[model samples]
Target: MLSIKNLTKIYGGKNKAVDDISLDIEQGEFIAFIGTSGSGKTTALRMINRMIEPTSGSIEIDGKDVMQMNPVELRRSIGYVIQQIGLLPHLTIKENIVLVPKLLKWSEERKDKKARELINLVDLPESYLDRYPNELSGGQQQRIGVIRALAAEQDIILMDEPFGALDPITRDTLQDLVKVLQKKLGKTFIFVTHDMDEAIKLADRIAILSNGQLIQFDTPDEILRNPANQFVRDFIGENRLIQDRPNMRTVEDAMIKPISVTADKSLSEVISIMRERRVDTIFVTRNDGTLLGYLDIEDINEGYRKGKDLVDIMHRDLFKIQIHDKLQDSVRTILKRNLRNIPVVDENNILLGLITRSNLVDIVYDSIWGETPAGVDEA
Candidate 1:
C-alpha cells in the first residue's frame, strides 16, 4: 500500500513540476498517472521513490514514512522500470535480472533460481540467459528490464513508460504480460504514461494530471462515461469508438450463441423457443434459410392477439449489425433504440449470435476498468 499527502515538488527557483497532490493506492492495485507533456505525471511517480524529492508533504510506503528510509534501502525495496529500460550493456540477461537479488545478498543458488524463473516468466528462451543486452531485440531487452526490477521480490513497482519505446505489437504483448504478471504477483504498480489509450487499457484506476495537479482519479469507465471536468471531458474526447475497441476481440468474443433462436416458425412455436431459450427475439429466416426479419417477443404477442401470422408480425425492416462491427457501435445502437439485444449476422446475412445490452455494457466497462468484472466473459 502507498499513500501520498499534499505532495509537492519544485525544481530550482520557481518551476513547480508537481503541485500539491494526494492519493491512496491499495495493495496489488495497478494505478496509472496519465497526462500530456509537462503535466508532472512522471515527476509525481519519481517523488514516491525519492528519485525526485518532494518539496513538501509526505509519502508513506506501508505506513512507514519514505523520507525516513535510507535512499539505497528504499530503492531496493521498490522496483523501478523506465522508458529506456536501463539494462546494463556489459551484463548478460541472467546477470541483469539477478542484479537486485545479488545486491541484496541472496545466495548464489537462490539468485540463479530466480534468474531462470524470471526469464521464463517474461517468455524469454532459456538460451537468452547468457546473452548480453545488445544481443537481444528491443522487446526482449525491455522484458529483461522488467525481470530485473521484479527479481528483488519487491511488492511495489514504479514503472515510468516501461513499454513506451517498443513497437506497437511488442508493446501490446508486453502489456498483456504485465497484466498476467500483476495478477500472479499481486504487486502494487505505480505506472506513469502520457498515452491515454495505454492508461485506459492497463490501469485499474486512472489518475489524470494537468498543470501539475491531479484532475481526476477513478475507474476508466467512470472517466469515460462521466468525466470529472471540462479538461477531462476534452481529453477523453467525443469519439467513443477509439476508447472501446479491443484489438483481440472479434464477433466470437462476446457473442451468446446458445441463446440464439431460428425464425420462420409459427407464433406458438416461436414463443416456445423463446421461453426455452430465455431469449426475447428469434432470427427470422426464409424457407431457403436466408435471414428475413427479427421475431421479437412483442411482435409474437401482438401477432397472436391480432390473429396475424408469424410472417406478418416479424420485423422485416429491422436494423442489423454485422458480427465484426465494433462492440461500441452495438452499444450505441442499443442505448439509442432502448433494445434489450441486437442480432449479430455475418456478411451473408447468416445469424451468428445475440449481443445483449448488458453484454455490450460489460465489454465497455471492462475496456475502461482494465479487467473483466466478476462473472463477465473475457474479451
Candidate 2:
C-alpha cells in the first residue's frame, strides 16, 4: 500500500506547488492525477520517486518511509515513464531494456531472458531486440518505452503523460495495451495527465487538483454522478462522461442490421432491393454473407443500362469497420471518410451489421437523455 500524508511542495521560497495533499492508494490500483496546468498533478507524481522534493509531509510505500531510503535505490525500485520516452538513440532496443537490470548486476543470461519476456509483453517480436530505436515506428518506440519501465520488475509504475505525444489512434491503442498489462502484471500505477477523459477511461480513482490544491479525488463513476463543487462540475462537465461512456462501445454492440444483397445478384435485382429498402446504397456481400463491397443506385443503373452484373458495378473500395473496433473510432472513420454508413465485419471479413448516421444520433440521444430517441409522435 502507498500512503501519502499531508504531502506539500513549495518552490521559490513561498509558492506552494502542492499544498498539503494527501492520498491513500491501494496496492495494484491504477490511480490517475488529472487537472488543469499548474495544478501540481505532475509535482505530486514526481514527489513519489523523489524526482521533486516536497517541503513537508511523508510518503510511505508498504509502511516504510520513502525519505529514509537511498534516492538511487528508491528510484530504481520504482518504474518511471515520461512523455519524451528519452530512449538513447545509439543503443539497441535490448540494451535500453536491460540497463536497469545491468546496474543491479543481473547475469547476462537472466537479462536476455527478462528482455525477451518484457518485449513479448508489449507484443513486440524478439527480432526487435537487435534493431535500434529509430528503426521502430512512433507507436512501437512508445511500446518499448513502456516495457522498458516494466523491465525492472518494479512494484510501482509512475507515468507522466506517457501517451501525450501520440496521435489519437496510437494513443488509444497504447492506453488499451497499458491497461491490459497493468491488470495482467498487477502493478500499481500513478498516472499523471491533463486529460480528464483519459483519467476516467483508465483510472480506478482520479485525483483532480487545482491551484495547487486537491479539488476532488474519487472514482470515475462517483465523480461523474456527483461533482464535489462548482469548480469540479465546470472542469468536468456533467454530461461529458455520459456522452463518452456510451460512445465507447464496440461496433458489434452498437450496429444494426443494414440492407444488403449478395454480389452475384443482378443490377435490376439490386435496384429493386434499394428502392424497397428506401436506401440509395446496397451492401454487396458473398452468398456466405462475407462483405464484398457496396453498390450505389447510380452505379447500379449505369451497370443495368450497360447490361452489367452486380459484381461488375459493386465498389469494393467502401471503408469497412471491424466488429471489434471501438464505436468512437468508427464514428471518427465515418466523419473522416465522409461515409453515410460503414459495414461492420468480423475477423474473417464476414458482414455482421452496420453503423449509420441515424444509429450514431440515436446513441447520442439515448446517452444524453437516458432514453430512446423520440419519434414524430413524441416530437
Q: Candidate 2: which stretches are off by over 4 Å? A: 238-255, 258-355, 366-379
Q: Stretches of candidate 1 above 4 Å error? A: 241-379
- Highest TM-score among the candidates is held by which one? 2
Q: Which candidate is the best by lDDT?
A: 2
Give the C-alpha miss distance for residue 153 in model 1, angstroms: 0.4
lDDT of 1 by residue, 1-379 (tens): 6999999988896888888899999999999999998999999999888998889999998899999999889999899999999999998888999998878999999999999999999888899999999999999999998878899999999999999999876887798689889989999888999877678767899999998999999988778767888899778776563444553466568878634335546788778878987777677776554667777788778889988887777777766668886554355445656777667778888766777777776666667765546654433
lDDT of 2 by residue, 52-163 (tens): 9879999999999999999899999999899988888999999999888988999999999999999998999999999999999888998999988888799999999999
Distance from true location, Cα of 173 in model 2, Å: 1.4
- Using all chains and alpha carbons, the TM-scores for the candidates as numbered come to 0.68, 0.77
Per-residue lDDT, model 1, residue 147, is: 77
